[model samples]
Target chain A: GAGVSQSPSNKVTEKGKDVELRCDPISGHTALYWYRQSLGQGLEFLIYFQGNSAPDKSGLPSDRFSAERTGGSVSTLTIQRTQQEDSAVYLCASSLLLAGGLDTQYFGPGTRLTVL
Target chain B: AQRVTQPEKLLSVFKGAPVELKCNYSYSGSPELFWYVQYSRQRLQLLLRHISRESIKGFTADLNKGETSFHLKKPFAQEEDSAMYYCALSGLANFNKFYFGSGTKLNVKP
Candidate 1:
């Protein structure tokens, strides 16, 4: 089975520019999550989507950061007016079900975003 | 606030030696813990979860509610075990949101 996949494995953008990172969750997955990994830092929770429920936007760092999951499969994280602080690896993961304890999340290869 | 903590940034062990990676979490409600691993050039994947109480690839973790810890351990380390490991936590009420630690990089030398 195909694992979670992210696009533009690497991206470079100038400060103040906007960029979008895409994620294709595993087929039949009902849960999707976005995280950011900064250099020498832990994975920071970004956003989450479960089935058709309202998305959890609490983890989003700022108003410039936003994500949307369409049809419960594909997710996109968009950062408007990119900043140097936004340079990090954006990771996407998906789980078969919504149970946190029982469902195991599978991660994608991550997109390394660099803001110059 | 829910948070996961990995005390050690790196752990080095010789092949055939015992290995332990410490993880502690703070959560007010019932917590779900998990260990995720990433080998060189590989995407992060689930290694084990506390609720499952199952070992994978010679690794096991015991969750201690009293101590609020879930330390990952293996009887004998293998060179192939070298990789980055993350300890994650999620609350029973907020299962979809995972709080991850900084992660520990393990190095197993032959």
Candidate 2:
């Protein structure tokens, strides 16, 4: 009955510091995704994880952006050496399956990350 | 690359008037289109999907392949309908990822 959830609702850090955003997908969801929303870029897909197979890292902006899903449930998005441009709202979503169509994704409240 | 476009950054309408939010997408294959909405102080949630062909909260969107558009429409706008609406597309080729538009902020004035 619970929807997706994210931690660290708000985080403020200095440039060059590392920040981690966590997401807890809904129960039995096999697909998890990370997205960033900001004034400049709008909403951009960062990464996705499906089951235990290899994760899709193509959407990641740079090498500093990385994510990992432990045991196919919880996911952590880590941004190393955070830059001022990395300031945005980090949103997490999950779906029942990874099929190509009609899969409704439920989103979390998102964590607002501010890199000063 | 697939892309979604929302030409209008903001759309304002009077309550009880017709409202339409335009959305256009670029993709080669049959695409799964979705409308997501976020009210003030609320999380993003799915409003409707084209495949389902169902209307939610009196809002409906028709996917036009010829024009590459899927505009959200409601005959009578309500104050509660004001929010940020995003058009998203997931192509069959890249089903794992979704391309979202810049989002249109709808303001319903009474």
Candidate 3:
């Protein structure tokens, strides 16, 4: 892809249901990131995947949220037992991890998830 | 603790007016800071980074360790510059984990 792409631009799910958001990062990018943007709260980092190393999941808000990057190209964010508070925009970004810490993340159009 | 903070939710400026978007971060060690902008209906894109210390589209930001701030500024605003701006930080403590502040929407009116 020319840029980071996200699937299902919008998702409406009932409370307690599970939702999955997908991201396809640019080819050859070594780093991928997931973030959640909501009212009051800013863009919150959820997880990061870089070249097969253990994902940095320190930013995940809770245990219900999890993500996996397959083949280092596509990534999926799964929110289990979704609650109303889960309503927000899920953004995915990718970057070429440079040697000089000059990574400039390119973000996707984001998936707007609404849990009712 | 919230690593990044963007104090203004919205900033309205007239065309040709000076503009400034405030951002602050809290980190013990040196952190990488960046400014990202999202145009209407477009994906978020990097506007600039403190590391590069370069200006883009006439906008610039300086990392102030003394004040713990990285404020985006432009001498004159253009209507096309109206967009959502986010300040971000990547810290050594959470290497590769980037933290973003609540974005400030800049509305440059004609």
Candidate 4:
């Protein structure tokens, strides 16, 4: 893709429902990241993926929040039994991740989830 | 834990006035800070980073390790500069996961 692309640009689900968000990163980017942003709040770290390495899942808020990346290209974020508090914008980013600490993240348009 | 904080939520300035967006971070090891801007209805994009030490769109941010600050500055503000700006930090253990500040809304009046 030309840039980091996210799917389901807007999702409105009832409480206790499950929702899935998708991200397709820029071609050949080695690092991918997921983040959550509440209305009028800063983005919160969620998860990270780097090539074929095991993903760093430390940032997942809870067990309900899980993400998987396949073939190191596309990633999906799943939220089970979503709560009202789960409503927020989910963002995805990808970086070249070559210069050790010089990784610059480019973000997607973000998915806006509204839990009613 | 690595944390990024942007103290001001809203800032209004006239065109051609000086503007500064304050950002502070707390991390135990070496710190990498970045500034991202989101124009109206546009995706969030990287503006600048501490490592690059380069200015983009006439905006620059300098990392002050002693003060734990990475404030973004511009000598003269333009109407196009009106947008939401975020400060981010990446740490050693976070696998390049960037921690973003609450964000500051810069409004430039014509």
Could you estimate the TM-score for every candidate? 0.96, 0.95, 0.94, 0.95
Instruction: Give lDDT tens digits, candidate 3, residues A1-116.
Output: 49899998999999999999999999988888898999766788888889655456778898999898889899999999999988999999988877765467889999999999
Pairs that collide in candidate 4 are none
* Weakest lDDT window of 10 consecutive positions for candidate 1 chain B: B89-98
Clashing residue pairs, candidate 3? Answer: none
Least well predicted 10-residue stretch by lDDT in candidate 3 chain B: B90-99
lDDT of 2 by residue, B77-109 (tens): 999999999999886545677899999999999
Candidate 1: list runs displaced more than 4 Å.
A98-102
TM-score of 2: 0.95
Q: Please give, for residues A1-116, the per-residue lDDT of candidate 4 as tens digits.
A: 49899999999999999999999999888788899999999999898888745456778998999898889899999999999999999999988877555466888999999999
lDDT of 4 at A78: 99
Error of 2 at B63 (Å): 0.8
* Cα deviation of A17, candidate 3, in Å: 1.3
Highest lDDT model number: 1
lDDT of 1: 0.91
Candidate 1 lDDT by residue in tens digits, A1-116: 89999998999999999999999999998888899999999999988888745457889999999888788788889999999999999999988764434487889999999999
Q: Evaluate all candidate structures by whole-model CA lDDT and list the values in order.
A: 0.91, 0.90, 0.89, 0.90
Candidate 3 runs further than 4 Å off: B92-94
lDDT value, residue A79 of candidate 3: 97
Interface RMSD in Å per candidate, to 1 decimal?
Answer: 1.7, 2.1, 2.4, 2.3
Q: Which stretches of candidate 4 lie over 4 Å from their true place?
A: A52-54, A100-102, B92-94
